[model samples]
Target: MLTPLQKTTIRATVPALQAHGDTITRTFYARLFAAHPELLNVFNPANQQTGQQARSLAASVLAYAEHIDRPGLLAPMVQRIAHKHVSLDVQPQQYRVVGQHLLDAIAEVLGEAATPDILSAWAAAYDELAALMIDTERDLYHTGTEQPGGWSGFTPLRVTRLTPESSVITSLTLERPGGEALPPYQAGQYVSVKVKVPGDDHWHIRQYSLSAAPNGQQYRIAVKREDGGVVSTHLHDRVREGDDLLVHVPAGDFTLRAGTRPLVLLSGGVGVTPLLAMLHAALTDTPQRPVTFIHAAHNRAAHAFGPEVRALAAQHPQLRTLVFYTDVQDTDQLGLPSHQAGFITAATLKPALPLDADYYFCGPTGFMATVEGILDELGVPVTRRFTETFGPSQQFILPAAALAAPI
Candidate 1:
């Protein structure tokens, strides 16, 4: 617990953090990585390069200072990041290292503005926050280890098969090295896949959503080849069947919620990966469950899992599939899967989907915004709409109480 004076002092610095959040986070990461290069193994350099990681951290720091007195208000966001840290096997000691770098960064960035009293208050605040995170992560690690077929840290997995799903996306089936059963993950979870990119001495990690229904024998993930993406390029072009990869335990909170209403799965681009798993889980367990899969891609060349999902819909009477192509090609034709050309709008979807349905959506931020904008206009209850972003876990359309900022 923070003293009243300490809390007030910390609150006073919120404006500075919000104003220079990016600079502080940028300096923090630079210094932290310089001091401990080994942490590069756990962080994605691409996110750093694009400044997404820094911005995410900045948001969290600002949010923390904003809610220093009401720590419970940050529980949902804390839980989300805690799950992520546990997946990467983040230890308590690492918090100390991060704190040192963060404090130094603040001092460097703020200079004279960081008075001794303010620094002390921030130190106390950081310690308070870090203790909560470390304890929460400790509990998460315990839960993961206690689960059946679960193991701590990274598991050595062998690529059993690799199939090109589309021009850009490739599917990889990974199983335990000794052909042991892997733990069954929730439909919408993701696993961190670590590999050494060519010419990089340090290991790089990237999380790919489990793209298939868990069979217990193996886990499947799809990698979309990002141009110049260190990990994606390595996985897509360099990695092959029979190769070994280090995989973390599946961890994510963006999952299918318990509901009996019409289930709608909306995805854009490769964001369809996790939603596919959710779709499979529902259809496999309850064929009569009314579900809709509305996906949009650039063209037929970029569209993935069309045949497989169409076949599933064919087998299940209650399953509905809708696809849209932004830049339709000659190969793209009007069909059950490809419904129209252009983006998903309320006009197109409102008539096709049930307003009472539970909506699960993921995609590029713009696409998600479009979907959510429509859902909001339709007055979908916050409880009924679930979303999972494929990139960093940042913004979410959860209830007001579930989050404030740093969502």
Candidate 2:
């Protein structure tokens, strides 16, 4: 526990953190990576390139400062991050490296203005937060190991099947070397796939959601090829069937909640991967659960798993599948769109959805924002609404403290 004076000192730094948090975090990461190059294997370079990782770190630090006294507010976000850390097999030792560089970065950025009291208070805060994360990740790591067919670290799996789902997305099936049984993960969980870049000793690790139900035979992941993405490019062009790749145990907290409430699973573009798993899960586990699977894409040519969703909806009356084509193709639906013409908005969706339903949505930032607005306007309880973002998440924006930065 920090002393009252220390807490005050810590709270005082919040303004500077809010003003220059990204610069501090960017410098911290650069220094950390320069000191410990081996960690390049753990963090996603794509996130680094896009400044997502720095921004995420900056947000987390400011959020912690905002709610330092009432830590309960940070619990959910901490749990979510702990699962991600567990997927990368992150250890407690790494936190020390991060903490040291972070403090050094603040000192460098603030110059002579970073006082001893402020630095010490920030150090205490960092230690407190790191302890919480480390403990949570430790429990997560242990839980994954204790589960059936689970292992501690990276396990080698052979790519058994490769099939293109759309022009840009491909589904790859992975199985253990000798047809070994893999651990079963929750419907929306993901595994960290480590790829060996050509001529590089260090491997690039990327997490992909398991796009299929747990069948005990193989785990399937849908990967979308992105422009200038290292892991996606490697997986799309270099790797093929019969090739081997290292993967960590599946981990995530954005899972389907168990209840009798009607399920609304929505997706956009390639965000459909995890939601597709949840859809199949509802089919096998809860046959009576009413499900509405809505998806939005640029056009029919970009839609993945369209045939499967259509086939399921055709056979099952309880399952309703709706597709929205923002840019309709000439060959799509006899030169027409599917159900809707423009984006999936409140005007287009308000009539079909039940207010009491359990809503699970995954999509880009704009898509999630739109869904959040629609749900809010419909007066759906916060308890029933769940969402997860595809790329760098912008989900939780902490209540900002209005304070001006000092010179």
Candidate 3:
């Protein structure tokens, strides 16, 4: 709990946080890594190198400060972050290390402006937030461990099979060494895969969405070969059948909701992994539920699971799928015969969209932004819009007027 004075002080610091949050977060990460180099094994090197992590932290801090008194507004953000933390097996002690470096960076950056009163208030605020996160993550950890066939921390699983899904995407099927049953997970959840490249000294961990509906026998994750991604490249080029990999329990908050309302699923590039799982689960669990699955890819070569989805649609009368090939070749048949040859637009989507449906989408930033804008223009209720981003969480910005108006 924060005193009224602390809340006021936090509110007063929002402007400064907005102005220098990025620099503060960058400095915090530098100091944190310098003091605790081992943390590098836990964090994404690419996100750090690109400063995406820093920017994300900065935005989160600013939002926290701005809404210090109204924590309810940040529930969704907190839930998302807590799930990510649990996926990484983040411990409570890490909060202390992060908070220390964060405050030090703030003091270093603000200098004269970071007075005793301001620093004190900020420290309390950080403590409150940290406690909340710790509690939330504790619950998540407990829930995961309580599930049947569940275990804490990372477990070694053997890669039983591998199939190339597309030019860049390959799906690996993993099972326990002794063929023990695996824990079930909600569709759209992801597991963290930890690997050490043959010559690398430190382990690298990356989260990949489970591409298949949960079965007690095995878990499947689709890896997209990234240009210079350490873990991804290793998974693509070095990992093979009979190899063992450390995998964490599945964790994510992007699962399908419990409702009979029409469900809309949209994806782009490799973002289709989780949604594909959702599609399978929805069809299996509720065959009568109407589902619209929309996906976009550069071309057929880049598209994954097209045949599988098409086959499923053929079998299920309630399932509708739309594919968009942005760079269609002359050889590219529209549609698989039904596919459109351009991007997803309002005009293209209006016919298939259900105005009263629940919308869930995952994709590249630009594609998601376009979809969000279209959904907003179509008068989709904000409560019905759910999205998942691949890397560091991103907040979609709406027009000023939209922000001011009630949903």
Prediction-by-prediction clash tally: 1, 0, 3
Which of candidates 1 and 3 reaches a greater TM-score? 3
lDDT of each: 0.86, 0.85, 0.89
TM-score winner between candidates 1 and 2: 1
Q: How well is each residue in 1-407 modelled by candidate 2, as lDDT tens digits? A: 77788888878889998899889988998999999898876787778877888988888888788777777777778988898888887889988888999999999999887988889998998899999999899899888898888889898999999999998999999999898798898999999998789977897888899999999879999999999887898999999899999999899988988887899999999899999999999988888989999999888789999998988887888898778888987777733233676788787887767647999999877888888898888788676777788765644543223222121
RMSD of 2: 4.1
lDDT leader: 3
lDDT of 3 by residue, 1-407 (tens): 89999999999999898889889999999999899887886888888998888988887888788778767667777888899999899999999999999999999999999999999999999999999999999999998898888889889999999999988999999999998889999999999998888888887789999989888989999999998888888999899999999999899988988788999999999999999999999999988789999999998888999889999999998999899999988777773556888999999999988759989899777888899899988998777888887888655222244345553
Residue 34 miss distance in model 1 (angstroms)? 2.1
Error at 97, model 1, angstroms:
0.7
Top-TM-score candidate index: 3
TM-score of model 1 vs. true structure: 0.94
**Model 2 TM-score (2 dp):** 0.93
- Per-candidate TM equals 0.94, 0.93, 0.95
Q: Looking at model 1, how many pairs of residues clash?
A: 1
Clashing pairs in 2: none
Model 2 scores what on Cα lDDT?
0.85
